[model samples]
Target: MTLPRYAYLGPAGTFTEAALRVMAPEGTAEHLPMVDVPSALGAVRSGEADYAVVAIENSVEGGVTATLDTLAEGEPLVILGEVVLSISFELVARPGTRIEDVARVSAHSHGLNQCRRWIAENLPGALQVPASSNAAAAVALADGSAEFDAALAPPGIGESLGLEVLVSGVSDRASSMTRFVRIGRPGELPEPTGADKTTLVVHLPSDRSGALLQMLEQFSARGVNLSRIESRPRGDRPGEYSFSMDAMGHVAEARVAEALIGLKRTCPVVLFLGSYPAFHGEVTPVEPETTDESFAEATAWVAALRDGRA
Candidate 1:
């Protein structure tokens, strides 16, 4: 069978690139390489692609802005699954290039920040240019063909861009991870893997006191855990904000269904995105270029610590 195409935030080999790979290891996945998260969703909604995978949140950065905005688009583009990948970023450039010669390091803001310590410490004279996507920045370095070469990106991205690894595993925090979601048309939801989470965005009745609190209470009353909640400015009315929530229950679940009904009653609008599987992948980090017995030992140590087996 011909596999479905995935519209992701990439040209190829972004962290988003890795998320798509995890979600559909056997399927024929194609990169949509959108300008932003919104454009990627539009691809899924308009049938330009079968699905859109977006980074919803990061461990340190909280909620992703474009992903939050795109979640407001309602149906035909529902979040079906969430996959979390550990982010161990790397610095890359054409081989034989030195850090002193590197002038501008182009990368997605998040990627650059992950490697800020390395950049700030090593290339004090170089400027950090913010690009939209990690892969996008790598693409710029590849296409620009200028002295403006170095970028902090996923190793997969550097490989795809024909760039060489300059510095490996540069993120300040070792446990850093980004959560991504798979969005697709309603009723066409994928089979529920044990690991999954759903996303929702709501606009409460303007100034309805405790309306937000009430919905959350219902979830709490039912023992549903909320993974994330962020407020976006309700542009229609200045100073007011809308709630974007990422919770641990699916619409298919009875509690989630009840919560939605209660939410609709309290809020003026309740947007239901997809309820797909969450990433069950091992949180293992791979440094660029070098890998050995020590790598396996370190990963095992992290796993042991996570499981309280240490």
Candidate 2:
């Protein structure tokens, strides 16, 4: 049997690689490390890999703009699963590199942002440089290619890469976490787990009063709970925007299907990103199965009567 191929943002020793391990353990599949999120997603899109895992959201940083925009605008891909990991950073440097002697520190933008307070307090005089990823930073520091004396990376990077940990627990909040999603070529969504989330993007037909409200009502009126909702510019018009939403329930459910149909009727485009199992915790059941069955039966009855059937 051939093992599956998985791509992630890395050179290794990055949080993304850690998340990938949780999804595909050692020896289960071949792991291909890409330079960035687009390349990872592109690997899957281009058939170079079976799936790609990348960070979607960070609790402190909110949405990862690169990941969000890529998924929103790129060729279709389906989210297969999600993984959430608590994040922490360590200040690593070449062995015997003193913190006081460190003139600069390097990290991925998000990692730098997450450790902003710690950097400000400890490395006040050090310049900040952004790398493609934490593991990239570690690699540079290890290879002596990075001009910075130290890097903010995952805890064990120091040991794995033969660096030294000058400081630890650098995240602003102890509870910080990042959410990653497994994406693959469009189609073959995960089986409904009773606890799931469906993500989609809605671009409105026109800007009008209560237009946003109208979109929300499509789900709100039907008791479909929304897990996340964000508006991004349509990229062509100055005032026009697109709404990205993650709502509770699988797209296979009647209420979710009805809400999507209503949204399609109101919006110019409704892009179905994919429905997959939820993380963090199991979702509370939204509605009874019988309620959806009853709604489906009534809809069929109405369609039959419209055809003049007794």
lDDT of each: 0.74, 0.88
Question: What tens digits encode model 1's per-residue C-alpha lDDT throughout 230-268?
Answer: 889977779888888866655665555556777777778
Q: How many residue pairs clash in each candidate?
A: 8, 0
Give the per-residue lDDT of model 2 (tens digit) for 1-310: 8999999999888999999999998999899999999999989988999999999889898888888878887789878899999999999999988989888999999999998888888888789999999989988999889988999989898778899998888889999999999988877678777788898989877788888889898997777899888888878888788888889888887788889989988888899989889985586466553347867888899999999994
lDDT for model 1: 0.74
Compute each candidate's TM-score over C-alphas.
0.80, 0.94
Question: What is the TM-score (0 to 1) of candidate 2?
Answer: 0.94
Clashing pairs in 2: none
Candidate 2 error regions (>4 Å): 288-290, 304-310
